[model samples]
Target: MAFNPPPKMTAMAAAAGTYKANLSALQLLMRGLYGGAYIAIGAALCTVCSTGVAAHLGPGIGKLIGGAVFPVGLIAIVITGVELFTGDCMLVPLAAMMKKINFGMVLKNWICVYIGNLIGSIWYAYLMAVGPLVSGHADGMLAVNAFGITAINIAVAKTLTYKAVGAAGMWSCFMKAIGCNFLVNIAILLAICADNVVGKFFGIWFPIMAFVSSGFEHCVANMYFLPAGIFLNHWHPETTARIGGLLQHFGGLTWGDMWLWNELPATIGNIFGGFFFIGAMYYFFYRKEVPKG
Candidate 1:
């Protein structure tokens, strides 16, 4: 029966937020690097584990499998105390609401952590592109496998599908991004509520699994997913060409498309969802009852 009450959890979150907001840029960046890499680990695992699952089990179950594995990253981030932009969107803002930090501090944490996350995500993406996603032949050539195809398809679906519909596409991506952070911060809160490892693990797992299974957009995950696809395409054009009309129909996966279609909007939406929906609302509901310092 051990659990923090809602007000206590809010206060604890605010305190954690304050601590995170005050971290040195180096600390924030380094932790964020770990955060990003950990998330990429989950993302990569999800991609590999769920490969061909849909063909066998149906898309719904494939998504569930992928979602099931994706929480490992967030669990690592929360348990190890690393900065993740999506989580920070809620945490730092909560601290600000409690008057424990300023907006400047919140912005600082977000910016540094975001850059670190992008760096870590892309770095892992590079590893995946050159490593497991491709196999080298005796003749010094490389080709992508089923997992590689899945990565490319993911990248295309995240970006080109949005671009194809123009404004409406962007809107859909934005809405999905909002849902993503809403669940993400909720996972963070649930993690805070738990008093032990097993409690925290399951607490973190469900919401994260739900978000990924629901096909929500997450900016940090996309940092890895999109670039992994881009790197794969660059490493193996023949494989990229195999994706066929999706490539041509959506104008292919370029850096511009990666940012314009997914990353940019997702980031903005994550901030809105995490901050307004979770951080602000929680503060509003629990502020007066939070024990005074």
Candidate 2:
């Protein structure tokens, strides 16, 4: 069959979640580390491909280009069966709601995967900063390239911009994250609905593209994006000067700002969006329709 009905898809999701919940701690962490690195690869590709694109092709086209290429990571994860924290934000909760997994199991999976993702993302960020972002330049020895500047700009925008608006900026990040994971979990569901590899690829691709192009915030992707910026800024003070104005208000990017301003709020919002909006809602809508044995 090419596609499963909603009830079947929900059942499949529950079964998959149960399987995920049963994985040992080490398994979850190892799978999740790969998941984080995969998503970072897509994020880095988006940054490099979209650099200065807006200047020549317009902002909308730039977003479209980035969105088009960004799904490779998620597609790879879905196909390879790596554990991604954002997708788990929906799946594990759905399993708990269906009584296939307990809430404690859910929490355990989340904590392990989240930590693994963080470690993987930061590790990739360091590699990217020292490698492609500067093209093998020694730290503080060479001028930052356009890609490096873009990385710093992304970091500053995601963090300090929100800090400037105080509460409202945080709220904006929260809402964007909600939108992000809603589409992400939808992509997960769509992948579940498909029986073939090609069907799964398109299923995951569209929603992810929509989320990226629409300017939604994704916590896992930001795990790579924000830290890459911070690493760049630390190594190249000259790049900070290039960014100018916002520097004074935020006092430059720090690890503190990255978590407090963007990652924390985005994580909370992703949980709400994935767990409640997509997971619970779908379960309720399809529960009675699921075939009983």
Candidate 3:
């Protein structure tokens, strides 16, 4: 027979329950990091498809390619499971701010996941741009893709990159990108928070659709796809130098000009856009009724 415990033993049980709650919070944070990695992988593949499709369809359809392919990645996230930083950008930050999770745990999850997503994106970009597989598409994929995309496409990419970065050539364009990201984040978070699967799908798919169609900035996805284009371009040293020189001569661009000038500010803009538009707003508007931790 088991011995009966004293009153102090009941206190120990409460302490153990508290410990378990904290542990569960930690687990949720890790889930975010894992999600980030998978999302990056999906974006990398999407970029490969988009880049190839854009090459064939022409730059005019690049926006269309973005609209179609990103939803596929989001499906991969919702149904099949992929790490998605954008979704977590809404979820994890909200959890952290609400003190539903410890700060160290939240930061750990975000940093690890962000780094993993970056690595996955770079790896995929390299494979898509330089790897033989990308060049192996049907109907002489290699020859046309190379010939059509080379030289001419760089200018289009650079222009898009500028709007993406934040040096929007005009404030109106920058605000547009910011607004695009805001709705995208709101949609993603709402989809994830929705009770039903269909609700989730529409929430994610439609907003992503809007952003892509509108040519908005998605810093995480861009973080993966853009570098791949640059890496593949860098494969031909002479072309790289000529391209670099041409950008300098005409566009007044340099090494830092590409990423720092465009990617960094865009990245900052994305964070603000997501936080204010999605996470904070939802917390204030929707979550006010939810019990406080």
Determine the C-alpha RMSD for candidate 2 after optimal superposition of all C-alphas.
Answer: 1.6
lDDT per residue (tens digit) for residues 94-189 in model 2: 888888789999999999899888888888888889888885445536556789888888888899999989999999999999999999999999
Q: What is candidate 1's lDDT per residue for 1-293, written digit by digit as tens?
A: 47999999999999999999989999999999989999999999989989999999999999999999999999998888788999999989999989999999999999999999999999999999989988878888888988999999999989998888899999999999999999999999999999998889999999999999999999999999999999888767776458886786654679999999999999999999999999999999999999788
Count the clashes in each prediction: 0, 0, 6
Deviation in Å, model 3, residue 176 alpha carbon:
5.2
TM-score list, all predictions: 0.98, 0.97, 0.67
lDDT of each: 0.93, 0.90, 0.52
Model 2 clashing residue pairs (backbone): none
Q: CA lDDT of 84 in candidate 2?
A: 92
**Residue pairs with backbone atoms closer than 3 Å in model 3 (clashes):** 35-83, 35-84, 36-83, 38-83, 39-83, 165-262
Candidate 2: C-alpha lDDT: 0.90
Candidate with the larger lDDT of 1 and 2: 1
The alpha-carbon deviation from the true structure for residue 285 of candidate 2, after best TM-score superposition, in angstroms, is 0.5
Candidate 3 total steric clashes: 6
Candidate 2 error regions (>4 Å): 136-140
